[model samples]
Target: MKKVLAGLGAALLLFVVGLAVYVASRQHLKFSVPLPAVAAATDPAVVERGRYVVRNLASCPICHGDPKQMERAQAGEEVPLSGGFEFNIPPGKFYPSNITPDPETGIGRFSDGEIARAALRRGA
Candidate 1:
């Protein structure tokens, strides 16, 4: 009985070590690479189309527009997008990043591609 128990314990220890080694090795594998860049749009119509797509389909206005304005929308006020809203996170804190086009206060310095990367690609 003692010999049988000793052998079973050794086997379990060896199995756990082997599983750890396999998992550690698998973490080093490469998955994918970045794609090549596309051509820029110089046409006004293309720009307008892109803007419409972002506003309606992507729903960029939801986070970027003023929270007060969104509330007023229910009451029939035609409030233009002017972003300033706080996002609450648990464990006791919150942050509100400005999204308005105001140069001094918001993302006026970022290029269109940077914005697209953040919104579309979910890249930081």
Candidate 2:
């Protein structure tokens, strides 16, 4: 019984230490990016081009898109992006961020610089 208790205690200590080290390493890996002065373009042509890129090239519409509209988008028809797609993968379950103009649930709350950096993944 004494030997078993000692072994269990040692294992618990090792797990705690390992978890701390993993957390510390992740914190060190975080990098800060300077926000740029640019804002999302408002030109109609640029807007349409961005939509085209997201729908076709990057295929973001197939993932970070409205669930109800996914069928249309998948069928090669352009659908409005209202990001709320979800998936589970390593680390955790995740949902694509809302990109619509809604102030409460979308990019409307974020500054232009933040949006630009996030979109370009400046630090990531």
Candidate 3:
């Protein structure tokens, strides 16, 4: 019984130490961005096509919240694309950002290439 208890205690200690190391290592992770390839479209047709892709094909509004606002967007009535969705998980509470063109709370500060990269690839 004594030997079994000692082994269990050692195993528990090892687990705790391993967990601590894993959490600490997460703080030092480096993010790398790739070079931009394509520029954002300026033509009205291209913009409309992108909007159609987002609303009808991609189902962005499903995750974005507000069916009525989504409907307005679907009708092409220039609705705000500000995202404020929250996803609760074991690691942390994940809040999706407001993606509107508003400079303060959205992706307005990001360049067109930056937006394209972020939309097309992970960790951009």
CA-only RMSD, every prediction: 6.1, 4.8, 3.3
Q: Rank by lDDT, descending?
A: 2, 3, 1
For model 3, residues 1-124, the per-residue Cα lDDT tens digits are 9999999999999999999999998987887777577778899999999989987788666565444576776676655667756778878987656787778988888887788777766644
Model 2 weakest lDDT span, ten residues long: 115-124
Poorest 10 consecutive residues by lDDT, candidate 3: 59-68
- What is the model-wide C-alpha lDDT for candidate 1? 0.66
What is the number of backbone collisions in each predicted candidate, taken in the order shown? 0, 0, 1
lDDT of 1 by residue, 20-124 (tens): 999999987975534334444889999888777756777666666678688774464534455565666665544344655667777676566665555456544
lDDT of each: 0.66, 0.79, 0.75
Predicted candidate 1: what Cα RMSD to the true structure? 6.1
Better of 2 and 3 by TM-score: 3
Off by over 4 Å in 3: 65-78
The TM-score between candidate 2 and the true structure equals 0.66
Top model by TM-score, which number?
3
Task: Compose the digit string of candidate 2's lDDT tens values, residues 1-124.
Answer: 9999999999999999999999988885756678889877899999999877876788767666888887787788876667767788988888787777678987788888887788766723
